[model samples]
Target: MDCTTVSLPFEMPADACNVHLHIIDPAFPNDGKAASQIGTVETYQALVNKLRLPRAVFVQAKPFALDNACLLDAIQKFGPDNARGIAVVNNTISDQGLEQLHNGGVRGLRFSVWNPDNAVVSFDDCAPLSERVKHLDWNMQLHMGAAQLVKWADIIRRLDCKVVIDHMGRLDPALGVKDPAYPFIQEMIDKGNTWVKLSGPYLNTKTGEPWEDATRTAVAIAEFAPERVVWGSDFPHVTEKIKPDEVVLTEMIATWLPTKKARQLALADNPKELYGFV
Candidate 1:
């Protein structure tokens, strides 16, 4: 996808932030997954520049697992002022280690329960880790599918810090609001401590690009918690065999957030609060 040729249907606020994306550098050791050819700081910067988003959050990619060297390096390269990270850390991390990560611009911990065998942090680690980071004002970012959402509802409700659900709770868009897990997600949002990333429609969408099926789910989530929703490109889109055009992905924000005010909140204001971006 040529990002340069793609344009947004509506103008984004100058402070707009892409709250979800990844930067995979081969310089760091990997978890043996095939590295994405286009996953790099330079390529991501180009995409964000083309989309006019000045801020970004470097999510810990699956390939790097618990070793955050690549994630930290990307954050350093992007500059702390313009970037923050969500790292994959376990319960055994020392106080000083957590402090170092916090100082290095990591504001949250990510727990991936979607792929259990490969998940660095399991459901059992979430609560204890959340308690550990509560004083730092860090949030827990959960990357899980619909079944996991339902399976982990109790633990999710008891989390000590704020929670961010990755990829619209990984719900199947064809089911729209009727998806069994939708109510559980809505319940979490109503608690006022949970935020949802309106990202990765491609991950669950049965329909192709423009992703009309997924749009329903995204809009439903945005409407349910306008202040709690944020947008992400899911760049490099590693899980897919073919990448979706970054341009089209950026423009989809127009449909998810239909008004300038809504866009401002999701793209700019919401991220600042969620990520602690100055």
Candidate 2:
């Protein structure tokens, strides 16, 4: 959806970077990639200008795993001052190369266990890689099916660096707040190292837009760990059959939080801290 169609509930902070964005280039071969959402530095810059949110965190989409050229290029094109990235790397990468990535504005590493077609890293690599990047102060971020969160609990708990879980732990609505998964996440948050991305209600929702089920979970997270909560547009929305308008999604976040102070923290302050955005 275009920016003019909807009214934003609160004023957007000038430098707010939508926490999760993917830069897609057809020149790169994405192995197991499905969505046709093609975004580039140029289009994204226009988006930033129109939205007035000056920064963005770029996650290397699955299709381009191991080949970080596109992701790095966008970060540079967007200017490291306003763009940061989460790259996908395996043990094969060298220490100097990693330092290069860090110097180039990559602040995190990602693993996607939920979608095998898009996944490049194995469960075995989580801890080792988590250990590898700890020196850089980089967080380990991953996306997995909800139930599988239980399997990796111990590994995540042992990480020396911070961790980020996408989409409200991908919790199933059927699982009440008291479920083992939420408690595990609560435990992580209590330890002060885990942050949750309030994103993709369309990914977890059964009822569709306005996704009350996912909304409740996101709001609960904001309440439970406001400092650890951050928002994402999941821009270019590759997963959905029909993309939800970004404007509506932004409005949904504003409505969910309802107060200017809370929304500003979620949209800008918290993200600036998480991504180290200037």
Candidate 3:
């Protein structure tokens, strides 16, 4: 779908933040793992204009691996007042490096266990790193599949800082709320330090477009913790061969939250608090 041609049916709150997106500018060198298509800050600004989501969190894309120059540069260009970042780093980073990232408006560190072969940081690095950044009040953002979620449930619960689960825990929509991992997800949310991002529905959907099957899992999470949820466009959708229309993705929040107040929390309030956006 041509996302640029589409517009949201309703106005988003002034502070609404798109908590998950990437900035892949070719101006920066990469480790040859970047997305096939380049997603520059200018390209993302067009999407921000189209979606009318004024705030954002620039997640460090995998292509750059541990080199956060592209992500940090995008945040600076976008203006830190309206942008925050989540970087990918390991325990070996110096204290000065961490502070530099913190000053760069980075409030979280992302660890991916889904693709270990290509992952920059492993599950083993999550705990110590979480502790390392705890004093900075940075959260630990996790990207893992359902099986990995179950496998790391114990460690996730014991983490020293806030947790944000990427892509709705990468749950399989075919399983819906009955997925065995659902219980683990519930426990994490009930712990009050964890949040779920209502993004990437297209990744696991059995039904396309409106993605009803995936929406069910999102609705269940919203019902479980309305204030503990946030929304993301997963913009540039690097993983998909055909990108899903982002307008449809934005509108899905209405069905997932089912109320203006709930939408307010997920869209605006929750993100401000979690990302430490002023």
Candidate 4:
């Protein structure tokens, strides 16, 4: 079997913007053979070259699965100045640890109720996490579905820190852009304390390839919150067999969000504002 893989379109230059963050995942696969071969410095360097060696590459550390020690080690080798990070945390992340992560250039925390393995942070827990982050002025990025929209809408409204919805609030494709749940996302955007990432078609698409099913939803989000909308290439898609190639996904995004100004906002400018990239 061929181990070779297809890479994204090379037409675009790497100096596209201030370091395009890779949102790195540090968790090595459990399978020893695969783990030893990939997830190394050489592997990451190759991947970065493939990404056109973004000006600054920030990786979302594998907070839930890996120890902070391992994360720090990776940063030391990965050019700390050229990188930044996001972490997973709940009430348990000690005050000291959070402060340290802040110093390390981690500007936000991601909480996902969608993953079965991760514990959901309840409202009681969320309030304090919101409080903790408020001091640092870091935002909270959340992942959820239609079922949790009402709950999240209220939670974000009350929270002090800005909230970013991952994967366009991870909408269900069956709902399309007109879903009542989508309005809640729009409402949050309208409220002016929220941002949404135009990433991960699998989260919103019902069928395979050419995930246009998500276009209307993305467009609606762009329409509702153009200033707050940003795009990400959820690279090395974990645990999904139907993974999207980066080039194709980028092209799809370009198609869905046509217009030079929209592309600049979605691809470069908006992310800088939300993520604080200079």
Candidate 5:
């Protein structure tokens, strides 16, 4: 619905501060407060200060995906200070409400099972919330499809912890990414404790230059192990009808990594060492 109309070709580096970004509008409300997409959080912080993003990690989509807590107090009040979060689990979550969302900088825990009638959590009840979120080291954000990635690949291989298969694994680009579930995400990136997010190629490109099927699936996932490839700009892109503009999603990530040192290690040192962002 004119979801932030997009159009891009360039403009991102003005001495880009190690390309920092982490925005989440997973419909941004969970009843700890806030809505109207939280008044677009100053219009997504003025589009990350007009795309000179130095740091941003605002997230909120599961304060038990909302029945009341006012969207987790409006994501702790319009999330900032390099915000970071991801929540939503029920079974009356306790352990002090998961240690008050792990001291309110939640690492991760999103599960959607891609429209099992808007599932809140499944994939076998996410192994006791992945065993109480593996004692708070979190990370279990699945949005599966790609034939359910080898039927949840042994529940992401016996859930020993750490996992984040969001967009890439949704690969289908008309089954051209050598589909066979692309070798089940190349055996979960050769089991070096999985992590992935070559961010949603417009929901797996039915065509419209979603980086031409996400640039050969991001060079076959940076040759299947570029330190567990990471990238994101899914910002405010909920239920897209073609909405992705943050300088054209950073020039479609420099045309999907067309160099400039693999676009400064996939947009600044691989998500600052995979979300430890410093």
Candidate 6:
């Protein structure tokens, strides 16, 4: 069941980078809670080696809240060239501290508005936080479902910095194309001010594996605006019962892309641009 030990089923262009992955460490102080608790930095490095991608972005785990010590530690170990970090922050984070995070290879701040249990930053907080980091040329990453996206579309439109929306935009299966969020997400992709991750189909799927309904959204977006889409493994997949085989994930992404060059672009070039990787 371990992705780190499984052989890659499909060949990935070596130049590609993984845009989403979490390194959860339970040792960090939380509100008496534990993180997803995956293997350590060395173990993650092993998964990276198996995948054969040198660049990755480590998203702060939900359990860790604002304490990014484990995340910071990994960034230092991986060095700025190979790793970028997405962090969580409260309203009080100082400008100097932000500069330090940037210097240490952190490129973006993340907020969660969907999962109420793990939610730290509220919608009211996004504006000021967006304003604060707008000057850093950093994006504001969000882990929210489609309903949340549509509900907050007005303000999201006004963000000074770009936005990176997670998990194939995670539209509800029942909504289909008629979903209001679909068009808005399309608009963001069309406007070139937003990017979405083609990751974690299992979480939002009803039919499973290939995620047929989710595919409807992802494929359409890829065809509509290939450049605005990127791929991620969401590795060591936290809190799910049916563990995903990385090979299946890779194959599924390939099908969504449907061409060698398209896969290459989504897997490598697009991520390099969004993540600032050389």
* Highest lDDT model number: 1
What lDDT is reached at residue 143 by model 3?
94
Descending-lDDT candidate ranking = 1, 3, 2, 6, 4, 5
Query: What is candidate 2's TM-score against the reference?
Result: 0.93
Residue by residue across 137-168, what tens digits does model 4's lDDT show? 77777767766766556766787788878787
lDDT of 1 at 214: 85
* lDDT of candidates 1 onward, in order: 0.87, 0.80, 0.87, 0.62, 0.61, 0.78
TM-score to true structure, per model? 0.95, 0.93, 0.95, 0.80, 0.32, 0.91
* Candidate 1 error regions (>4 Å): 1-6
- Candidate 3 C-alpha lDDT tens digits along 1-278: 23363555565787889999999876788866454757888888877777778899999988888899998899999999999999998888999999999999999999977888878887788999888889999999999999999988888889978999998988878897788888988888888899999888887688976688888888888988998999998888988889886667887776887888888999999998899988
Q: Write the per-residue lDDT of candidate 2 for residues 217-252, one digit (tens) a residue.
A: 788888888888888888788887788876678778
**Candidate 5, residue 105: lDDT:** 62
**Model 5: per-residue Cα lDDT over 95-129, one tens digit each:** 88777776766666677677787676666767678
Candidate with the larger lDDT of 3 and 6? 3
- Model 1, span 119-223: residue lDDT tens: 777778889989989999999999998988998899999987889999998886678778899899899989988899999988868887767888989998898
Per-candidate RMSD, Å: 1.7, 2.1, 2.0, 4.4, 15.9, 2.3
RMSD of 5: 15.9
Where model 3 places Cα greater than 4 Å from the true spot, the runs are 1-7, 33-35
lDDT (C-alpha) at residue 159 in model 6: 90
259: Cα error in model 3, Å: 1.1
Better of 5 and 6 by lDDT: 6
